[model samples]
Every structure is written in structure tokens, then in C-alpha cells.
Target: MEMKIGSKSNKIKYYFLVPALTVLIFMTIVPLIFSLGVSFTNYSPTRIGSWSFIGFENFIRTFTDSEIGTSFINNVIFVVVSVTIEFVLGMVIALLLNRKIRGISFIRTMFLLPMMVTPVAVGLMWRWLLNTDYGLLNYFIEQVFGITSINWLGSYSLAMPSIILVDIWKWTPFMILSLLAGLQSLSQEPIEAARIDGASNWQIFRYVTLPRLKNIIFVILLIRTIDCLTRSFDVVWTLTNGGPGLSTELLSLRIYRLAFKFWETGYASAVSWLYLLLVIFITTRFISYLYKQEF
Candidate 1:
């Protein structure tokens, strides 16, 4: 009997994927490896001759450093508060726009405008609008409440909250779009059945609508939480540059400051690694939840 070569042929088939995998490894794995290695040493490029292995010292410093401590706490608060507000506002917008109404398509498209704008542009535009001297925001506030020259981004107490407000303004549309898509995709069979079974609107929504929306809501929370943590650099940096005394310092902006401003590359690497770990943890949990729902 002739031995079939099918097993050998099948084993070799994966060779075709090698090139793409090689590129992926190069693009992602290499930087990760380099960053990981650098985190164990003082790898400042400007002080090449002074570099040396420091092991966990950088990580220790990250915990002990008062600056990092403050930034971390502030970042956590910002993420929680901003994400909560954004999710609530997004749900409202999604509910309102989910109905069959006149000019729905046009309104939906218009609502998406904020999400489509570049983050840098959004930041700059808000920066102008939050200017203490002449911003439109303060202008209206003064006109309505009879105040003048309120410092939106300049006040230390208000700086962080101001940035959070900006984040919500720019990103609420993201939440809205996701929720709207989920709402649109829901089946009406159960909803109609609930309505016929003597369910009130609030009861139908609470029992029928929100239950079906749990998975999507979880996904959106995970995604938006990560974005709120990492991609906040543009709005925060442009609006306050992590100032009003580090009040607006987020993880991303903190990392940028360490890496570029201070040129403490190895220390920055350690911080970057921490950021990566947080992202990985959040993403893993999200995927696990999704899988559990699927099963």
C-alpha cells in the first residue's frame, strides 16, 4: 500500500503563514522584548556610558515616588468618573436615537461627527474653547451666571475635572455608537412578547432590554475604559500638559513625560511595562467574559 503523504503535506502547509507571522513578531515582539530588557537597566540614550542594570529598582521607585503615586491615584479617579459619566450620557443618546423618527439617518450621522474627528484636533479645539481669557465656554458661563475669566484649565482644583469633561465630550459618541449598534441589533420578538404580557415600558426596558444588552455593555466598558486610560494623552496634554501641578497626569502622559522630558528611558520602560500589564489584564478579563457568555 502506498503511504499517503497527506500528513506531511498538511504539516508543511503552515509554512505559508511564516512570512506574515515573522512580520508580526518583528513589529510587536521585538519592541516588547526591547522594552522589557530595558526596564531592568538604566538605558537612557543620552547617558549611554552611565547605563547599568538596576533590576527592580525602577519598579520600586515607581511605587515609592510621590509623583507617580499622585498621578496613579488621579488617573484612577479620572477613569472611573469620566467613564461613568460617558456611559450614562452615551446610553441616553443611544436610546433617543434608536427610535424610528424623522431625519434619523442625518441626525445619527451628525452625532458621529465627534467620534470621527482626530483626537489632536479635538484637543486643540477644546483648548481654545477652555481658554480662561476668551474661551466660548467661559464667555457663555459669564453671560449666564455673571462671572468673568474663570480658569477652566488653569485652576489646579478644576484642571482634572475639566479634562474629564473634555474626554466625555469627545468620547461619549463612541459609547453612543456602540450602544446604538447593539440596540439596533436586538430582536424585537422578546420585546413584543414582554409588552403583550402586561409589562410596562420601564419594566420591559429593565427586564428585557438591559438583560440582552449586558454583553455589549461589558465589551464597551472594557474598550472605553482602556481608551480612557491610554488615549487621554491628546486632550489632557493639549489642555493642561499634565499640569496645574500634575493634576491631569494620566498613565500615558506620565509615561511620555518620563521617557521624553526627563529621558529616564529604563524607568519609563518599567512604567510602560506596567501600563501594558494593566491593558493585558483588562483585555483578558473582557475576553473571558465574552467566552463565558458564548458558552
Candidate 2:
């Protein structure tokens, strides 16, 4: 009887789990291997479902392409600058709201409104505001500020910045929320101790606060880095579509164009792999830095 029950339980467990494992292998593992395999080939709709393996040629050419090179450089700049700006600004806002100010919860909720809005919606809203002709921004600039209408998206110089502006507006709330969680989770004893020791706000933050929040900060950075790289499609696609002659062509955007626009599946696969590796590398370094986290 016991053996029969044990066998029945084992069968049920396998039955329940096998479907999920099969889906994983088919959806994730298989696609990854296929994509990796396609990265080494000349696969495209034009090729009639045939592949000619050219080991690393796609990667080599992608790196060597000057347009691609420029895009890669701009991607690096965007990641560093945007992430830094968002983190710092978000930290500031989170700190301000952490105070027991009047109506602070309401204000915190308001700050999160931008984050709650859809990315595509955020892009559209910003696009309308930043439009050079009759845009609210340009109108304000020309009429009230006595400034010329700026070509925010059209101009190469301002396109990336415009993207960053929209991103910061949408994502700063995320930073604030993450840091707020960190702040709320901190034990009050150390903070109170610092207060009693005649430490200035700056000193307290520098000594007592920042250290404890390291893991939370790193975790947010990790998540936001992945998100900013992968899920930036709606904002960039709606705003620029990697336009102004590829001035804002991020890696994901570049991969997208390669696969869809240019129909270079192999090349797109290569770009995707390389970009994925880069994100993983940066994230891994940060993860490793605080691998044995206290939290």
C-alpha cells in the first residue's frame, strides 16, 4: 500500500512538473540555443530556410560597422548618464518624501503616478509637449520665455537628451520607490543614534544611512539596468525609433532594425547576443561586488 501511494504521488508530481519543464525547454532553452545557432549563420527569409555557418563573422562585422560602432558608443553614454541621473534624482526625491512631512503619503503617491503611466503613453505625452511647432513646450518657450522653438527630436544634439528626459520623468519614480523601500527597511536605532551624536544630515546619511542601503541600491540598479536596456522599446520606438540617422539607435533598437527592417536575422541575432552579454557582464560585476550581501 505504501509503495503504491508513493508511486502515485511521484507520478502526480512528474505529471504536474513535466509540462512546465517542457514549456521551459521549448520556449526558453530551445529558442536560446536556436538564436545562438542563428547568430553563427546567414539565416534570413531570403535564404529559403537555409543556413551557412560563418563563425563570429556576424559579430565581427557588427562591431566593425561604423554606424553600429557609433550606436554602441551612444548606448554606453545613455546607460551611464541616464542611470546616474535617475538614481541621484530619485534618491533625492525618496529622501525628501521619507521625512514625515504633512500629506507626505499623498505626495508619494503623486510622485509614483509617472511610473504608473504606460511607457508608450509617456512617450506620446512628452512628444506632444516637446513638439517644435505649436507644442506646449515650444509655445511656452517662444511666448513666455522669449526663446526659439527647439527641434528636440529632429536635432541630433537634442534627440538623445529628449529620450533621457522622458525616461527620467517616467523612471525616477522607480528609483524613488526602490530607495524608499530601503529607507523604510532601515532600523531606526542607528539613525536616532546619529541624531543624538550631533551629526549633520549629511554626516548621518553618509555614515549611517548609505551603508545599510547598499544592497537595495545595488538591486535596483541591477533591475533598472536590465529594464532600461530591454524594455526601453515603447519610449524610444514611439519617440525616435532610433532616428535622426541612427543618433539614438540603442542596441535593442539596432537589433530590432536588423531583424525587422533590414531582414538580417543572423546579424540581428549577433547584435542581440552581444548586447545581452554586455548587460549580463555589467550586472554580473555589480552582483559579484556584493555577492555575499548582508541582506
Candidate 3:
């Protein structure tokens, strides 16, 4: 009788999972499989019923297209420059915050406000501040430094850098919070022993704190890199719409333009699949290196 009751309870639990599994298959699995099929066809939404398979033509074009190449190059530059700055600045801020200063909690909260704001809102707020005329930033520059108003978003040379700046501002807080948590969780015995050995602050950090924080650092880097690659659409779209002659276009924006603006759904699907593969490849490498370091 006890066995029968236990079996019935297990069956009841399985029945409860049925709805969730059904939703997952329909919402995620089905769409993914459908899109994979669409990527091999010439299925322009504008053409509706008159679409057919074109083998690997779309994938071939993705490799040879100059515009895609340019967008990819721009993305690489953005990721490298922005992530580097964020890591450095975040480490500094995290170190400072780890100290037992007065009002440290309040300061940490204030530092995180920029990250809590929505990306589109950050873009819009910065857009106004970066305006050439009568903008707050320009006003301050003119008053404090005697510099003329500069067109931040309108220039080809400055457009990509401006986008990077916005990204850094919005994301550096994540690094700070993540690193701070790692620091707080670390066992204090090693750090205390390092101090007893007459090690300087820099030496203690270099020898003790950093090595322990490696796993957290790797995790945050992977998360941020994937985010910058795929989900930076709102901020970039709002800031410049890939303007200044595609100077600030990312792969996400490129896919958007191809799919919606140009109505080349099949080509867009192919590019998106390639983009997904690139992300997966990078993530796999990151995990592999992390495990190697651990072992």
C-alpha cells in the first residue's frame, strides 16, 4: 500500500510537469526548428507564397558580404575596447568598495543606478546629453573647459566610440557588483596571512585575492560578452540606428535591418544562425579554458 501511494505521488508530479514541457516545446523548440528550416530557403516575407530553397546561397553571402564584414569588425572593436575598460574600472571600484568606509553601502547603491536603468532609456538620456547644442554635457564642457559644442552621435569618427561609452557606463556596475560579491565571499585567512608576511597592498592583491577571484571573473566576462554580442540592440538602435554610415552597426543591428527593413527573412535567418554559432564557439572556449585553469 505504501509503495502504491508513492508511485501515485510520483505520477502526479509528472502530470504537473506536462504543461510546462508542452509550452517549452511549442514556444521554444518548435520556433527554433522552424527558423532553422527557414534559413535554407529564399523566404522573403514580402514575397509571401513564392519562396523556395536556395541551398547555401544565403550562408555563402554572409561570408562574402562587405557590409556584414564591416559590421563584424565594428562589433569586435566595440567588445574589446568596452569590456576591457569595464573590467579595469570595475576592479578599481570594487577594491575601493571592499574597504569599511563610512556610507559605503549608500555609495554602492548609487553606483548601481546606471545599470538598473533600461538600456533604451540610457540611450535616450545620453542622446539628449550628447546633443551638440544646449545639451547638459556640452554646456558643462563649454563653461568649465572653454570647449565648443561637439556633435557626438553625428560624426563618423566619434559614433562608435560614443556607443562604446554608453555601453561601458551601463555595464561597469555589473562588473563591480559581481567582483565585490566574489571579494566578500573569499576566505579572509589567506588575505590575513599575506598581510602578516609583510606583503604590500598591491602584492597581496596580486598574489592572493586575484587568483581566488578567477572563477567569478571568468563567469562575468562570459555573461557580458554574450550580452554585448546579442542583446545590445535596444541601446544601439536607439542611439544611432546604425547610422554615420554603418560605423556603429553591430551584428544584431545588421540582422534586424536585413530581416525587417529589407524584408530578406531567409538571409537574416542565415546570418542569425551564424551569429548564434559564433557565440556558442566563444562560450565553449571560455568554459574550456576555465576548466583547464581549474584542473
Candidate 4:
């Protein structure tokens, strides 16, 4: 009777999971498999019923294409510089907010406003603000510093920096929230002991606080890096559309151009797969570091 009841419970649990499993297979697994298959063929919608298996040609192009190379380099710069700035700014703000000062709660709430806006909305809003003519930024600069016609998004040198600045403005709050949570959860005993030992605030933070928050730092960095690599499409698309001679084009924009703009579906699919592999490699490295630390 006991064995029969256990078997019945197991079956019921499986039954409950059947719908989710089915959805996962259809939604994620099926599309991934289809895309993988398409990556090997010279498939294009324009060629309707005339596409053929090209076998590694698309993969070869993904490696050798100069535009893809440029875009990849741009992505690396974007991920590194933006994440570093966000981390620094977030840490400073988190430390400030961790204090029990007056109006701290209100200030923290206000800091979250930028991140709460949708990416597309953020992009649209900044695009207007950064416009050379009739822009608030240019107007302020002209009034304050006698500067005029600063083309924030049109110039190759400034366009990438402008995008990075906007990204920092939007995402720094996420880092602050994460770091603040980590800071608050940390035990006070060590910090107090360090304070009693004639250690300066910087020393305590560098030696005690930073080591304790390592896990949180790693987690936020990993999450942000992956997100920037994969989903940073809408903002860049709406902001500059990878313009100014591909100066600001990241791999995602490159993929969009190949797949839709140029209709080189097979090549785009291969490039995407390579990009996924790169993400997987970085993720694995981070996981391995965590595993080693645990052991």
C-alpha cells in the first residue's frame, strides 16, 4: 500500500510538470534546434524554396568578416567600460545610501527612476536630449560654457561615448541596489572590529567589506555582462541604429543587420551561434571561479 501511494504521488507530480515541460520543448528547444539547423544552410527568405546546405561557409564568414570583427570589438569595449563605470558609481552610491542619514530613503527611490524606465523609452528620451539643435544639453552648454553644436550622436568619437553614458545612467541604479543589499546583509562585527583597530574607512572597505561582498559583485557583473551582450538591442537600435560607420555597432546590431537588413539569414545565424558560444565560455569561467572558491 505504501509503495503504491509513493508511485501515485510521483506520477501526479510528473503530471503537473507535463504542461511546463511541453511548453519548454516547443518554445525554447524547438526554436534553438531550428536555428541551429538553419545556421548550416544558405537560407534566405528572398530565395523562397531555393536555399541549399552550405556547410560551414556561413561559419567561415562569421570568423573572417571585418564588420563582424569591428562589431565584436565594439561590444567588448562597451561591456568592459560601461560595467566598470557602473560598478564604481554604484559602489559609491551604495556606500552613501547604506548610511542612516536624513531623506536617504527618498534619495534611494529617486535613484531608481532612471533604471525603471523602459530601455526603448530611455533611448527615445536621450535621443531628444542629446540632439545638437534645440537640445536641452546643447542649450545648457551654450549658456554655461559658450559651447555650441555639440553633436553627441552624430560624431563617430562621441556617439559610442554617448551610448555608454546613457547605459551608465540607466543601469548604475541596478548595481547600487545590488551592492546595497550585499552591504546591509553583511555582519557588523568585523566592520566594528576593524574600526576599533584604528583602521580608516577606506582600509575597512578595501580589506573587510570588499572581500565579503565578492559573491554579490561577481553575480551582478555576470548578470549585467550577459544582459548587455544579448538584450542590449532596443536602446542601441533606437539611439543610433549602429550608425556613424559602425562605430557604435555591437554584435547584436550586426546580427540584426545581417539577418534582416541584408537578408543574409544563414550567416547571421552562424554569427549568433558564435556569439552564444562566447557568452557560454565567459559564464563557464565565472562559474568555475565560484566553484574553486567554494572548495
Query: Which prediction has more favorable TM-score, 3 or 4?
Result: 4
Tens-place lDDT digits, model 4, residues 48-90: 7999998999999887889999999999999989999999999
TM agreement with the true structure for every prediction? 0.92, 0.91, 0.94, 0.96
Clashes of each: 0, 0, 0, 0
Candidate closer to the true structure by TM-score (higher is better), 1 or 3: 3
lDDT of each: 0.87, 0.87, 0.91, 0.91
If both were scored by TM-score, which would come out higher, candidate 1 or candidate 2? Answer: 1
The lDDT of model 3 is 0.91
* Model 1 ranges with Cα > 4 A deviation: 1-5, 282-295
Candidate 2 to truth, TM: 0.91
Q: Pairing residues by index, what is the TM-score of model 1? A: 0.92
Model 1 steric clash pairs: none
Q: Which candidate order results from sorting by TM-score in descending order?
A: 4, 3, 1, 2
Residue runs of model 4 more than 4 Å from their true location after superposition: 290-295
**TM-score of candidate 4 versus the correct structure, residues matched by position:** 0.96
Q: lDDT, candidate 3, residue 183?
A: 94
Candidate 4: 10-residue stretch with minimal lDDT: 286-295
